[model samples]
Target: MKIPFLGGRQALLDPTLVAPMSTAARPELTGGRRIGVLVQHGFTGNPASMRPWAQDLAERGYAVEMPLLPGHGTRWQDLNKVTWDDWVATVEGALDKLVAENDAVVAVGLSMGGALCLRLAADHGDDLAGIVVVNAAVDTLRKDVKLLPVLKHAVPAMPGIANDIKKPGADEHGYPMTPLRAAASMFAGYAELRRDLPRITIPVLFFRSAEDHVVDISSSRAINAGLSSKDFEERVLEDSYHVATLDHDAPRIFAESAEFIERVTREQQG
Candidate 1:
């Protein structure tokens, strides 16, 4: 008997097409400042979704690190065995390394990657200059999520939420199926994240796709209501979806993020 979405066969992905390799760049000092940036991809997503953005930053002479999260950049079935803590630990380790090596560090993330960045800011704000989150999720209104605890035990996977981009031919190369246990762990941690939002006192640059299909507006609203940062800013992506980092507004995201990083890092120096 074959389960609907239980195994690696459900992915049907061409591994080469995914561009799953991790990205790292250690450039010469920019304006005599040793600045670093940590770029992160979302849940079930590899470095493919964030490579372009990470590359753009690296070109600007900043140290950049985009690590492949455990259980990602591989078969979807492997994700089922990992928990949310595994994802957070990966990004946190990257941030720690950057902080120790640079005068200032900025963390940038997409989707669930954004949530991990926020967690870092909350716990390590003093070590970070700022953070940028694109289509980040902190809270959800999806009633079905309440059943995740039970559903995950019965079903191995569900329909995927990847590639929610408005641009034609844009692919995040994420999993074709959502592993139930992994997803359940992600949503389960949101409450704790929300509670710690007040701890994120550093500057935050938030990007929300106007037509996002994966993460809803409730997340932005929650961030707006919960953050204690006076430097919080939200920009709307008019022509993109959940994967705005890879959508038509990608250039805008890169340009603005570069400016944000420069300004925040400079400000930290003073």
Candidate 2:
């Protein structure tokens, strides 16, 4: 579909690149422990960004569910038609499925994916072992955001915020334009998310890029200040940008997250 604001050109969405992924747990690899993980991608992006991370966890004997959220993995214009609740419902369903089949479950998300994970943690803390969020955005400092209520009616989309990586060739395969109506919906829900932050009592591993063009430090500060989890740990990704999952520091994120998942799930089982 041709995005409205962008010139009349159809977005080239590769099916393989944006496909949802699922991997069953191999208990023998983890000494017969069944652990499941819900991995999620960001707004305007699809499972491609989290595929490697999900695969890494799956290789470590964890059941992984990397779902393509509603209004994503398709055209940017599709995103404009979906609400924040649609995105949340998709992740919640994925998490629910993982919880039913595993002894323990952890959620991992990037950017808006991170926000969705936090929401899951708030509502389903007892169902989750822990959560890992990379460059999760809960709030924005942009003055343009204030105009969204009026601007969304006038404009269909703005510039895209995908693929903010320091590594040269890495791509998240996200939409080229940011859907204004969807962006406003995501931003509007942040107030309630912030209010519910104190309900997330499970362990949280937060990763923040030292330099991110798309999301500033305000979000990290809000998260750090609002979370009620005593087990929260924040790590700085010095070498990457907002899309840290596919950037130079991606290996670090994958390794540390795996370790965190292992430890948290083991503790939950105990």
Candidate 3:
């Protein structure tokens, strides 16, 4: 099947866009590993945005895996056809890869990725080292989400995509339209995890954007207030919007994640 457009409105189909994971995208499995981190991306975003945060953790001597979820990266239509299980499986694979190599493993994700991380932690119970989510999607009611209750059940038109800042010299292709069922499934995944929030005992770091237009602020508050882990800490990024991972507030993400990693590896979860 033909791939979907990427961004900037072009029919670009570069292999570099959706090829298998680059070698650098996977963390090294050296014997001296400390913290193993699996980083997941948001709804329409590929692994590119999380690359910086992964690299930041790696530089701090922590292992990081930025997995590109199935159906993501190349085409939004591909994502529309995917199930939540497929997405969760992709993250599970990366998390296993990291935990297998390192002595300790902590899951970290941004946006939808954060939900994925939370799911893994809750499922594992006390087996996980920790989980940290930045601007996670607990309950997303975007200002633009009005009247969609009808469009959601009446007729399922494939929804369009949205983008924030992109890396320089990035290839341009149009975002494939989003399927409404896909959105519902992904939301259900977060909802299921949200219910288990009070059951998650691992350390969690919740970050929010004061001006985030993508994720709902109430959702962030709900996750912070609902988690069972008493070691949770919430930080609000004042300088960025929804896509704080790549926005100007990215440094805060790196710093917070680094601290989370340090604490997890040090067994500071008390």
Candidate 4:
């Protein structure tokens, strides 16, 4: 019984989820001037999760790169083959290339990718045009986590068994079933960066799901309260799950992100 590459995930297993390992000769970006929107998927997710959002943004005129994480897009065992740092590096590399081609670079990331973008805004302040974080996993110690402590160990550590029996949505992606070590690394990165949130001074947009089950909803306020940037905006998605980027609010997310790019591009042009 050989497991297929997709494992019957949310997508139909077409194109096998294109990874962004090689930033080779990409076609010239049209519809807008040198603006790139680099997308980051969740811990166990592949590029497929961000595909809808990427396509939406691309249609509105932005170069998008939804990179498959180092060990993701494959099997659970492969995730263990890489570390948190490797995942972060991939994101940074993608952003670098986007910035290289485009005069302005903006980023929109989900979950851990959100954390990576925040860190980049803090460190690479001068380069970024802006950032939009949807369900940004800035902090891990949410009130819900305390309420349902068992989920922490059960979901990622023992996937297909301990995962979210309450909501089958999580199981749909067929995300890495078992990556306990990788799970721990995720929180560590989030924690290290939370202390540095104030360092992020670029114009930022934050999308928080009002009915989120995974990430701490308060993170939106936390990011808003902490970031040094004066041009920060936060919105709440009334109807959606943790992965709002793939769920109901995807289009609104794309629209607002496009607006962010346009606003920043205009500012740069002016």
> All candidates' TM-scores?
0.93, 0.96, 0.81, 0.80
Candidate 3: tens digits of C-alpha lDDT, residues 1-270: 223443633253455543333232223433344566677777766666576777776676666677777767664556557768888888888877866676777788878888888888878745577887877886865643444445656645464444443333332232456656567678767667778888888788888888766677778777867888878888888877666777777887888777777767677434
Off by over 4 Å in 2: 1-7
Q: Per-residue lDDT of 109-154 in model 4, one digit per residue for the tens?
A: 8777788789888878788888888778777554433433345455
For model 2 the local lDDT of residue 249 reads: 92
Ten contiguous residues minimizing lDDT sum, candidate 4: 160-169
Model 2 scores what on Cα lDDT? 0.91
Q: Which portions of model 1 miss their true places by more than 4 Å?
A: 1-29
What number of backbone clashes does candidate 4 have, counting pairs of residues 3 or more apart or in separate chains? Answer: 0
- The clash count for each model shown is 0, 0, 3, 0
Q: Pick the candidate with the highest lDDT.
A: 2
* lDDT (10s digit) by residue, model 1, range 1-270: 112344437544455544533334444547878889999899978788898898898888888888888888768888998988999998888888887787889999998999999999999999899999999999898999999999999999988888888889888888878999998999987888999998889999999999989899889998999999999999999999899988999999999999999999999999
Task: Report the C-alpha displacement of residue 260, candidate 4, in angstroms.
Answer: 1.5
Task: State the TM-score for model 2.
Answer: 0.96
Better of 2 and 4 by TM-score: 2
- Evaluate candidate 3 by giving its C-alpha RMSD to the native, one decimal: 4.5
Ranking by TM-score: 2, 1, 3, 4
Candidate 1 lDDT at 104 equals 89
